[model samples]
Target: MTANERDNIRAAMDRLLAGIPLRSNGALTIVRLAEEADVKRHVLTHRHTDLKDEFYARIRAQGHVPDSGRRLRERLEQAEARLEALREENAELRAVNEGYARVVNLLTLENTELDKGDGARVVPLRRP
Candidate 1:
C-alpha cells in the first residue's frame, strides 16, 4: 500500500527471485521472506500482487523444487541448535574462568598469611 511497504515487498521478492534457497535464518520461502521484510502475507496477496506473481513465476522458471510443505523448518531448527550449543560452551568457559580466579585468590591469601608469621611480620630486606 505505502511506498515503503512496496519497497520492502520488492526487496523480499528479490531474495526469492532465484526460487527458494537456504537463507541463514531459514529457507527462502514466501513466509520467511515476508518475515524478513517485516510485512504480512496478506500484503503480498491484496496490494502487491505483482511482486507475488513474479516470485512464484521465478521459482518455476529457476527449476528449484519447492519443499514438500513449502515450509522447510530445518534451517531454523539448525540455527537454534547451534545457538544452544554455543550457550552451553559459554557457560562452561565462564565456570572454568571462575575456578581459575578462585585458585589465584586462595594462593594470594596464603602468601599474605605466610608473610605475617610469628604474629609480628618482619619486612624482607631489599636492595634500593
Candidate 2:
C-alpha cells in the first residue's frame, strides 16, 4: 500500500476505535473501517492485509465485539425463541385437531345408529 493510504487507514482505525468515526457508522468492522478511511474494502482486505490483521488484533486486545457480530447473535437468539414458540403452538393445534376428529367420529356413529333404529321401528300395514 502507498504511504498515504497506510496513513489514512491508520487514522481511520484510530477514529473507529475511539468511536468517533467521521465517515462511517463506527461498527468496528472492516467494511466500516474502509468507509472511515474513504477507501475501497478490497484495499484493506487485499492490499493492506497486515493493517486488517492489526485492526482485528487491537479489537481483540481491547475485548471489543464488533457491532455486526453482536447484532447477529441477538438476532439468532430471537429467532430461536420464535421457533420454540411456534413449535409449541403447532403441538397444541395438532392436539386440538385430534380431539375434534374423535368427536366427529363418535357423532357419526351415533347418527348412523339413530337412522337404523328409525328403520327398525317402521311397520308395514296390510289393508283388509
Candidate 3:
C-alpha cells in the first residue's frame, strides 16, 4: 500500500478509536473503518489485514462494546423484566376473575333454589 494510503488509514483508525470520526460514522467495524479512511472496503479486508487485526485488538484490549450494541442489551433486559411483570399481573388478574366467577355461580344457584317453593300453601294472617 502507498504511504499516503497507510497514513490515511492510520489517521482514520485513530479518529474512530477516539470517538471522533470525520469521514464516516464512528462505528467499531471494518466497514466504517474503510469509509472513514476513504478506502475501498476490500482494501482493508484483503490488502491490510494486519491493520484490521490491530484495530480489533485495541478495541478488545479496551473492553469497549459498541454503543449501539450496549444499548440494545440494556433495552432487551428491560423488556424481559417488563414481560415478567406483565405475566405475573396477568396471572393475578386471572385468579381474581376465577374467584368472581365462582361467586357468581354460587349466587345463581342460590337464586334458583329460592325460586323453587317447598310445597307450602300461603296462609293469611288474621289481624287482631
Candidate 4:
C-alpha cells in the first residue's frame, strides 16, 4: 500500500479500536474492521509488523497510545470475566444435560422391559 493509504488505514483502525464496543456481540473482529476501513486483510494481518512502529508513533503523536493501553486492559478484563461466566454456564448446562441423559437412559430401559411382552425392539431415533 502507498504511504497515504497506510496512514489512512492506521487512522481508521485507531478510530475503530477506540469507538467499537467491547461487549458481547459488540466488538468488531480484525477482519471486519479491515473490511470496514477498506484495507486489505493481508496488510492488517501480515504487513502489520512493517507498520507497527509508524502506526504507534502516529497514534502517540495524536495522544492516543497511553490511554489506549488502559482502555485495552479494561476491555480485556471484561472479556475475561465474560468468558469465565460463559464457562460456568456451560458447566451447569452440561450437568443438567447429563442428568437428563441418565433419566432418559433409565426410562428407555424401563420401557424396554415393559415392551418385552410385545416383542418390541428398541431403535434409536434420529434427531432433527
Residue 69's lDDT within candidate 1 is 41
Worst lDDT run of 10 residues, candidate 2, spans 114-123
The TM-score of candidate 1 is 0.43
TM-scores, one per candidate: 0.43, 0.72, 0.69, 0.43
The global C-alpha lDDT for each of the candidates, from Candidate 1 onward, is 0.73, 0.93, 0.90, 0.66
lDDT for each residue of candidate 4 in 11-127, tens digit (9 for 90 to 100): 665665566532222233455445655677677667765554554565566665444477899999999999999999999999999999999999989987978767777689999
Give me the overall lDDT of model 3: 0.90
Error of 3 at 106 (Å): 1.3
Q: Which stretches of candidate 4 lie over 4 Å from their true place?
A: 1-65, 117-128
Question: Per-residue CA lDDT of candidate 3, range 1-128, in tens?
Answer: 57887788899999999999998879999899999999998988898888989888988888999877899999999999999999999999999999999999999887777668685544799999
Query: Lowest-scoring 10 consecutive residues by lDDT in candidate 1?
Result: 18-27
**Candidate 2 vs 3: which has more TM-score:** 2
Lowest-scoring 10 consecutive residues by lDDT in candidate 3?
Answer: 114-123
Give candidate 2 regions above 4 Å deviation. Answer: 115-128
The best candidate in terms of lDDT: 2
- Per-residue lDDT for 71-122 in model 2, tens only? 8999999999999999999999999999999999999998789788857543
Q: Model 2, clash count?
A: 0
Cα-based RMSD of candidate 1? 11.5
Q: What is candidate 3's CA lDDT for residue 114?
A: 67
Q: Is candidate 1 or candidate 2 better by TM-score?
A: 2
In candidate 4, the residue pairs with backbone N, CA or C atoms under 3 Å apart (3 or more residues apart, or in different chains) clash, namely none
